[model samples]
Target: MKGVAESRDRSRSVLRIGGVSGGVFDRFRSIQDLAKDPSIHAVLFGDWISEISMTFRGNERASRTPDAEQVAFEMSFISALKPAIQDIAKNKQRVAVNAGSCDPEAMAKVVQQLVKDHGTDLKVSWVTGDDVTTQFKEMLKSGEKFPSLPSDTPIDQWGVEPVCAQAYLGGVGIAEALRHGADIVICGRVADAAPVVGAAMWFHNWGREDFTELAHALMAGHLLECSSYVTGGYYTGFKKELLQSRNCTNLGFPIGEIESNGEFVITKEKTAGGIVNVSTVTAQLLYEIQGPLYYNSDVTARLDGIHVADEGPDRVRVTGVVGLPPPPTTKIGITARGGWQAEVHFFLTGLDIAEKVELVKRQTLESMGEYQKEFTTLTFNVTGSVAENPKNQASATVDLRIFAQSKNPDIMSAGSHKGVAPDTPSFAKWVIENCLQGYPGGTPAMDLRQSTGKPFFEYWVALFPQNKINHEMHTFNGMTIPVPAPTVTAMYPRQQVSYDTSSPLPLDSWGPTVRAPLGHIVHGRSGDKSSDCNLGLFVRHADEWDWLRSLLSVGKLRELLEEEDTGKKIDRFEIPSLNAVHFLLRDHLDRGANSSSSYDILGKNVCEYIRYKKVDIPKVFYDRGTI
Candidate 1:
């Protein structure tokens, strides 16, 4: 708490931020919320999680419709939150967005119409450069050829059918809209992180590859893109306090304070219904993190040497973001045929949670044994969302869940049919007499999805620098500000240098390139650690790669390393050639998740192992490994 107050060095001139989140569905709500503020220099949206857009325009008859999948994407962000955005525009507050999902072309028309209806002099343009579904089809119709990824097979053989095909565009497309004198810019499939970063770059007139400037924009965008995550939305325990303190219904939007190094701290406007604390920020830092390296389509911002300090009240200052060059390839969202997947959830509240779960498990297994079902697969769970270990408590309750999948229709039908609930002895007595909707209501149908397509790094992220993506856009009415113009700039493009998929960009993420000076290169090494202590760090994007390099360059980095790793400056060593190992580190103390740079929930020993990497020190070390 003491450190939280001193977190922000007021002497510094960084454009700080309020908060951030990774969920894509907040686009509409965020826009609606922030739109009310005329003081906002600009607005930007970074979304990839949901397809609110497909819902807004009311997609193709179910046959060709893209799945909503509960994602919070742009299209929905805007339409759902239109009233608030209009109020912002009327107030003359500047805003922007890239929440169009894969329908930028259609979204473009929507924006023009929306602006016109508002009767504000706000000129609007829907930016569409990456989505080439029509272009690809036209080419195929006329016999032009194109090569597909992996196989490089001709378009005809690839059998490409995109309900939406938006190429991730960058600053160039954004600038295109600005040049046309558009007030609100709309884009589809741009990098989710790019819109806000682009807005900052445009607002500050920051150029591409101006490492620090690029870092600033990247940092700002990162903090404000997510709606409530930064502002008590997903805050654990903190939300209880916020809800108790203020109206939970009026959730606040995140605001950011960005610096030149692309480091930012998030805090909402005062009296807002959210709490900006270390846990919320750090949770997001570790949430969905692949590992040490984090990537996205536009740039890779490294978390090395990263510091997050809560600066009292609502301020949280963050630093040490490393930036590197972007990769040459782009990541494609390939939803390949994943077959049929379905989930069912039910609550069991009468008795012991464990007891209830065991009974359900036993019954389901027994049913499977009797039928020798060929097309059914199931795993029952006691919780929801991301998995967590169950804890037993008195009168404990549980939400039972079942997941199943199959490819054959007839064989699957043998498992369970729809329009009727499955009756088993454990729950059969409860269901037949008083059956409700949620318990095994329908037969499983074959669901198909292509894999999350992996694209190259060249695809740029576009932003409509005019609005935030919001889910509950009605909140914009609270503020009477008018939204203004668009602002944007792209991160430096990835340099050409490689071919290898063995190393993925971090983990779950399928993107982006390792930046030059930071990504996919071989650099300095210790003659001591190995013949080649030289390592290759592939982050999710260019920003992360660059940030890693910066962390190693800090004045205290080498001094600290020398004292700890044996009186020698291991980072000072150099080598003849560095292939794909991105950058050189004079002294890098690479470690696992328990690094002291992060929250230390572990005992003191593990803390020291993270802080000093000591076998034994002033304090004894107790490792999680030991536990």
Candidate 2:
């Protein structure tokens, strides 16, 4: 193996790394494609686990013995890496992944076996200390309070015990493994961007104090972390014309070329489909982020000053990211069994749709009588609206969904009622019995399986002291190294940075206004982090930046999203570099994806919903063109 200095001098100043997987089930073939590319130095995979996945894996871990061959890690990663191992070894490239959910040692052992099976000499390593479920429980018993991110409610007051907890490890351990000559490093629940940051750290020989470079690398990793997200997938500008012009059938995964100076260019394979431009990159930058300050386990990145530009076709350059000291603590996710929940849907067609829904809701509640009080949450939601003057039966139909949850499984159980009266039926049965006594044109959905209750998990995100984590890296050569937490750190109080977009004239001063969808001149992307939702909206021209920043205030957003707004706090910020206005809606998704009964469980539809809303827009801006 060549030394760091020798390798740097021998190659270009840029380190090219490919991102193959965005989630656990992402395309497996991309791994082989990137591994065969000699220009790529390494491959990084992100999004292996969430709170719900952790809960499922925690149960699996609890049920399994220590000597179990098939432990609780992402098994799909093995299939993805099997065909790519020989290519990776032949090309002399490295690989890093967080597919080691709850168990990195087992994942590493599996990879080592694959390497041996393929007759490859590539070394394997694994990072530990991320699964701190036992330690977390011990701390809780010792009066350590882990406050929930959505509501700041302490664990004790949560009314449930956590089954598992995982700390977000940084890139230092990964870099240590790479430095010790490990060609592959498997990790458990590290920060999503840790692999990219660690690979860059090893390539550049950067220390923990190299804040600026680390920050830039952090943003680079963020862009590549979601794979096709930075390369036209889920892009707001994905229109029919763009689709017709470009082949998006098999979208390519992204590649980040990080320079020694910290600036990086994002691009994809030449033979692959999908487009990479400023808009795609900017859309991804705003995805799942709360504010201008992007907190990573390694560094706190200030994104307000970031600059993105189109360098060439299928390439975009990102720079000007400011870095602050690492936070003293990192986010830890704790998972607990929430309860049982179930729902039944009824279809209402044609005119008098609202009346039909009301009739059914009244009947269902009346039948439940005092039994309704036993349910923790019971909601009757009417989704969609009938079309005016009916074009077809399908278009004129709407769904009235009845969702219920309870701590007592019997309350939501699929079996006949046990406690309340033997004559009393299940929740689904109560609703279905009303079918004969229902309103005009009322029919229950065919899917009766969903009427049965299913268990769900609640996720609590809180900060844990980094020093408490037993961060370590174990190599194939039997070397174990301890990775230390950053000594230099800063505490940033939770405060929103408001941008002054005051205009000398009023909003209507531009010209005559027309009531149209906000998407006519705006593009947006929204995503959920726990229960909070971040909606990022941007415009095409620089001239419209001030108008956008001024128009989409907290009050305006609440007004636009009035139905979804539950009187929760909303944080607003501006990214002037991208001509974007971002808003964070706190406590928006009913306890997040796992326990959420909302139609938009992941909150990905919030942007489209807001964009579809009709709002008064400057006709001049619309004249330019719709996004």
Candidate 3:
């Protein structure tokens, strides 16, 4: 129950903070529920803005008049905090969040108004300068290049021009805002863990060079950043029994109790639903991270040495987190209008599913004729399959999707079919005309609106010099504080760290093996970072770790996920403490979520698909039971 009041004395050991929101649509009740807890010193909100969101906000901003009211920030946070303002004030709790997204000034104003209307004296502050669009454009004009993260292709060669760009800020600005007596701090596009790191920094009065303490706080932020993610939301071990035994319906958000010695315990409310154990913590630790060294704007965290252990029923203690100076540059995401994209689906039922798909593809292309050449990208994918001796019609049906994108909107629009004949050059006309000519049991989906093109965006992520950003913090009392980039930074090369686990003993040493899905003995979590996907696979038992490390390599991963393998480079790393091996599949998500036609655009299900792939599992491991 150690709170902010005790932490201010500088002798107190722990600072407790609750994670209220993970993304744009997370539950609003989290804030209200957590703010009422006396043990909770502060509530952190991580409103993650993906590439598509940035593009959508940019388009929205462009469409507005000069004098029009701007509400570009994530308004859901305000709605969530409105009802909790009184409780938060009464408890004297602090608040930090990156929900400001594209507009922190406006978001801060709204929060200030809400606090005033609620008759509370909670001071609100905002951090800005993450928006580097103008500066980025100027740098581009000056012949400076910003290369793409995966391909290393310069901006000049990208073909598309960025409409909006935002640099990822660190926690320094947030800490500065807190130092100026601000109870609430709003920020635009700060790192997801910045709010938590800032809160810890302010509570413990940690200096900039407190790398060890900062790194611990950074990892704590990461664990709590995704809210229920560390509390079994996306757990791979969600079986029927587990779901029934635990209250999966109302999963609780996580809270971090960080000690002064750079160790912390992750737990949730005792009365709330969901389980918080080592497995959940390990799964989250391995989620969305690239390699052994997890880089943030403030500190480069060495996660390879970290250990997670179950302390109690709903508590997992994390320790041994090493810290290094951050890199000189921070990541910046640039969003550009790519073009128009459209898709049409045809249902394939019963036998000859493959033949039906081919027939539909041939007919649709032939019907489009020369118009097919106009499309920038066109794909024909047959998704799912019928079960042998299926009992139901739904189980016998699959989908044939024809996805197309073009720089020319007419090429993908339904209006192009207006003046054309049934066999003429129109995307919609082509699919509809194939009705009778297609294979047996083939029928076009009733929803033809997809045939009409809609604008899509291309997202580019790369590193930008942190010193170039106009990082500043504006306090509630009109005091503006300049937050400088780190003076000391290590230039770590962008390469996978070498580990002993990479060269494991031969497969025969593990004993006789049985052909089974990897998920039978292994648990995994997958997530997207721009176009690249990071898949972290782990085992519960120490004996199984060797088998997992040896069996799941870059080659093995490619073999398992052959359909997704784009011949792109894949990097591998290991975390021995967690008995995990992680893979970075470069350019795997097909230009990422914004423009990807992939069903699993975010790459969240990549691990599940890989787990479904049959692999050789040691008999002993298989006997232990499925994860």
Candidate 4:
């Protein structure tokens, strides 16, 4: 084996990698930009995976051969990327991606074919064995158990049989593919940041013991993994006046220049839209992370003391990331047939809105009667305000959404229910029949498909020991290299830390106060991790940090999310360096993304919603407009 000091190449040490897509539809313009940048060593595309991949038909057969339609859906990015791929080949650069959801080998063949048709000699290879749908069943039969995350419940209690399963593979296989001269490496079900880590490790010749370098690259990958997120795409806190100037609509994807010293500068295409600064990087750092330890299959990133510094315009330097050995296990996403779901909305508007809602609900319940009993889950969500005012009908109208899900598909079907008599109408028909009897202005949405039962999948995330996985690298020239197990061990904290009881100066001491949305003085970013939701709240001014930390305690968070809290566990952590407070709302998402019933399934909008909650802002800080 070549040592880190002797094997690395430094001419391309800048490690310029641009993120093309977060999923299938994320910004595609970056690919062309990547092709134009000769210095860029590689291009990493996150692409669509898991529940998102399920949108394509035949995803359940990911372990098997994909049909032409499935292959077309999976390789849709390649069509737009052909010209870019040719440019990359001309520049002698490489591409690493996890866009090959279930059939990476097949995707690689298509890519190779594209290269051949273009008359370029670029080689393509794909990593395999991430698909564990068959192995999972074998393991379960042999007495292996895969417990659910956070809850630690037995897999059987998940209430659905897994249709397809995949383990989060490491980046080593990708590196091996690169080492064997593969110009493009396609992967399936690897962690989102694997491509960056793989490319950085391969370029720098970093060994397993180079934990610090790996950690830096991991954070770099994390910052760049979401494409435009680190480049002002979600930085709405930048005041309307300032944000509008950046023309965020045509946001550019990020490029990280990672170095061997374990430090990197995050910058995007200069000609593209959006801004990059300490604020954007910091917000992205605090996005969707779990506590202090950010674990990946390759290595664990200790983010307790991470720092983001403003180097210059459109550039941010991230440093101080600590690294630990890789965890013993990897997270496996087991997708199961959750059941079927059906939803329809009734518009309730104007005077007597409350009465109209109640009338609609009462009649809907009565209409379903015994049929409702067959539903495994049912919900009534009333959205929008009926504030007293002489406003337009649109302002006064509220959407009363009725949603139901059940393992018994017939229960949620448009025209059938196992429990109901054959002659009786289905729930949809019943609801329509009662529309005439409902409130005077009640009207259901015109889309009839919403009332029909459609299959939904439950995403059960569990930890599977890395050693049990059959991970390997498939070289461009038909050779396979088995990936070794991680050298490090990891164990989560046995107990969570209780909230800090320290008190701060009273709100009155900060001078005059005004009741307004907390967003005016604070910024927040929220995202989902499995069934849990991570919410990071930050303040622009150092002086305001203390106020934010003390004011938004667990108790305060509970009060703010009281209606939606549902008595779930909440863990809060304070990061003084970033002037931020992070909270993990356990079991907040009804289930994982695929099975979630909420409109904001991924919880991406939770931060904005929390920002809308009214809170007292000190007039002094409020005046600075830096909040």
Best by lDDT: 2
* Tens digits of per-residue lDDT for model 3, 1-627: 123243244555588889988888888898899888988865555555556676677655545678888678887888899899999999888889888888888989999999999999999999999989888988889988898887777888877878888999999898878777888999988888999888887877787778898999999999999999998888988784257675888888899999987799999976688889888899999989988888988998999899999998899999999989999999999888889898999888899887877778888788877887788789999889999999999899998889988887666667753554443356677778779867887678898898888899888998988999999999998888889999989898867574435467899897899999888878889999889999999998987888888887777888888867899888888888999999988878888998998888889999899988998888888987877
* TM-score of each prediction: 0.53, 0.95, 0.95, 0.94
Q: Which stretches of candidate 1 lie above 4 Å from their native place?
A: 1-33, 44-75, 79-81, 129-172, 236-250, 259-265, 310-312, 337-376, 382-400, 409-627
Better of 1 and 2 by TM-score: 2
Steric clashes per prediction: 125, 0, 0, 0
Task: Report the C-alpha lDDT of model 4 over 315-359, residue by residue, as the tens digit.
Answer: 899889998888788888887766788888898888787788788
Q: Candidate 4 overall Cα lDDT vs. reference?
A: 0.78
lDDT of 1 by residue, 139-219 (tens): 447775444322234445533233333344444345334433455666655555566665545444455555455554554
What tens-digit string does per-residue lDDT give for candidate 2 at 372-446? 987878999999998777778888888889998877777676574445654445787788888998988668889
Off by over 4 Å in 4: 1-9, 54-59, 62-73, 241-243, 415-424, 494-498, 501-509
- Cα misplacement distance, residue 261 of candidate 1 (Å): 6.3
Q: Determine which window of 10 residues in candidate 3 has minimal summed lDDT.
A: 1-10
Taken over the whole model, the C-alpha lDDT of each candidate is 0.40, 0.85, 0.84, 0.78
Model 2, residue 156: distance off in Å is 2.6
Instruction: Mark the 10 consecutive residues where model 1 has the least summed lDDT.
Output: 523-532
TM-score of 1: 0.53
| Total clashes in model 2, counting residue pairs 3 or more apart in sequence or in different chains | 0
C-alpha positional error of residue 401 in candidate 1 after TM-score superposition, expressed in Å = 3.7
The collision pairs in model 3 are none
